[model samples]
Target: MSKRMLALACALALLLTACNESARPQPSEGAAEIWFAVGTGEDGGPLVDGGGAVAPEYRALPDEADPVEERMAALLSGPQSAELRSPFPSGVRLRSWRLEEGVLRLDLSEAYGGLSGVDLTIADYCIVLTLCQVEGVEAVDITVEGETVPYRGRKLMREGDVVLSGGEGEPVAITASLYFLRRSGGLASESREVLVTENDTLATAVMGALMAGPRDQEELYLPLPEGTELLSAAVEAGVCYVNFSRAFTEGAPQSREEAARLLYAVVDTLCSLDQVEAVHLLVEGESLDRYGGVPTRNPLEKDYEMAGEEKPAAASGS
Candidate 1:
């Protein structure tokens, strides 16, 4: 065959192959592999073990900005009860984090400085190690309120900096404004901080924590009845849907004043979430018409009258 004819045939074959490949079906994305640097071992030193995302888009490798906030949320929430304590201190928040080229820059709130000495160094390593888990990030630089600061004797921290926390140390704690009955009369709120273990969505975790009730000697009250379980919870379109077990109704307060206070506790706590501006209480996965004399048929917003004050505000996608 002529060289011209051979060349034309090869070109035609290549085009057909390309078309066939393009026509093949594509697979759905799976959960991405991720790791969270935890303070484990006796020393409370920075250590990391496997953790990952179930979100479909993250099934495989992921981009830096894709879920930086979610990871930050997990970090701030503290490790599981059995895991080593959180490296960060209470009140600290990652204002924002970004990656450019190979460097990851973190802008932290003033609360980030609450730690000092070995604890402070471990906290910095935790941030660097946790973020470096991302495929592209290799180094970390942190700033407080836009000003650069020193960390671990150097301004730059890298992926391998994580080490076991040493010496006797306690875990980080985060506070929440929980509403409870005032021994004298009406509704009131108190700030309580603990090393939280969040196993599900933030909305559900908040509800679950509430149901656990107050700890020993805690001045606050947890009015929710015993055996009540957070079947499931989700926040969408600015409303939190909380489905509770039957124990919720059985253990609920009958008096109007106490009932309103109890209901508002769930409402106010959920509304604290950025996505939840209101809430719908449910039992066994279905909405209830009424539970505490407050109208439940409709999605409920904060009752400033019962809450004792109006909610403050929003944004802080932090």
Candidate 2:
């Protein structure tokens, strides 16, 4: 071959080699993993010495020298004051935390109680929002003790009791207060003498009230859209059948997931009652399974044993 032809052939061979190399599977930059020493917040900042297991790859995030627990505590304690108080008290104790891929795993202590439907919703939003605010975190998995709270009706990790269903009834007459977050700073509290009753079936009572109450008014239970009406509710076997007028279906603006969430809300409310084992979504006196594709098992259904299953009379943190 001529010198020019030889050079051309060499260039083609190099290009082919490059293509072959590109085609070969390259190992992942591997999932970024980091270890954050858990720390408690003192007057200054997180008191970190340097001793903690490395966070799993799925729960790992961008490297930070600060203790993860202390940072999380500060974040929870900061501007989102109202968000944390919905379950009642203003204390959230972190048991553990890990980060891998884009998900943050947060293990909370049982001290974070008094959580209700609204309160749990607040907690969900708070954790997701807070973690996603961090540069690398895209999602969060929250667990109490060693059990994980199932989100969107599926157990991503190990099983744990979702407080969404099954609570105990302890009638306590305490001065009820509502707190709203101010744009400026701190929470604005309004005191009212409302009877606070805790019952495994209390959520059911709230759902019943929502189903029976006026559609035009706003209450603690049913937060309806522009034009929705509750038709009826009945308990059959273990299922609580909740029926709503066509207006309830037509007037409410909800996506598939949102509708599922709404259904879970209702189910969570009702299933908290000992008498009701599950909930059936209905519209215009028919099961939503035929029309709306509502799942037979709603979001609140979980496999984990409840917090007080073994010890029936265990008092929840107030």
Candidate 3:
């Protein structure tokens, strides 16, 4: 094993070493259901349930083997049914696994890193939904060769986080209070009516509008740079985690005043939502210690002082 892999193994061991064995669920004696990506329909045609589609097949657990390990191995081994397929690449192997509390962490060989986007999502949840069936497991955290996939949607995935269905509600018109840069400086709220469909979240809709820039460009400045796109946005607790594409940084404002405005415009806009009290921003799914001269090491609360007639504040010493 490489040094990185060895380090990860040692860390995993240390984390789980003191865990009570009795707390971990033992493998059942009979067949256990293992999940696989749904490749085709019964008629030998392609599936159109979006790329994260999956189905399950039952396989017996070895009497004397580790249940979690066995389940992972079966998943990596691919499916026996003709209509199902393995989400893992051919060469990927499960190197190590450990369970602590209710979280199961699995470290796989390098080949697993090849999956991304919807393919990665399907592969990940295939493991998650499969293992979550075990008595003690409530969530699954996966790493490829001991390193987290940089752009994967979430760090720890739990069941019910995703639902595979075909129904979408009609678009309903709702007004969102979005923040945009003032022509002179600082930020101001713009109340606009936005349509939200079943696929849209209010936070996401607000973000999309922010990224689209202000409709009246002459009156208000676009805080987010041209070409910026919102990758994902969701609220957990009171913090809204917002992930943006690479264009956000590439086209970012160079001036400190504009950067501060850009950062808080997102923060204040999302905070306007009832569920979100703060904003955690990310570029290309990775956290940054600083965005230009702005400190982004923590989730930022809505700074009312940065809004309206007020000018952008000076850089913080902390």
User: Candidates' TM-scores?
Assistant: 0.45, 0.31, 0.44
Point out where model 2 deviates above 4 Å. Answer: 1-71, 78-91, 113-116, 150-318
Tens digit of per-residue lDDT, candidate 2, span 1-318: 443322221220100011122322233452222212122222111122211100111222335534455456544443322211222135557877788896678878764443433334334444543355455665677776777543223323221221211223322221212222222322222222222332112223344333332322322223345445545555555566666677766755355544443444455445543234666767777755432246553423421131121222445678
lDDT of 2: 0.39
Candidate 1 lDDT, 1-318, residue by residue in tens: 443322221220100011122332243554332332232332211122321111001123244546666666666776553434566545678888788898888898876654432345446655664567666888988888777753335677775543222122222223444456655555555444433231244455556445545554345576777766667777665677888889988888878677777888888766654345688898988778887788798888866566566543433655
List candidate 3 segments past 4 Å from native.
1-169, 309-318
| Model 2 weakest 10-residue run by lDDT | 10-19
All candidates' lDDT scores? 0.54, 0.39, 0.66
> For each candidate, how many residue pairs have backbone atoms clashing (under 3 Å)?
9, 13, 0
- Which of the two candidates, 1 or 2, achieves a greater TM-score against the reference? 1
Give every collision pair in model 3.
Answer: none
lDDT of candidate 3 vs native? 0.66
The TM-score-based order of candidates, best leading, equals 1, 3, 2
Ranking by lDDT: 3, 1, 2
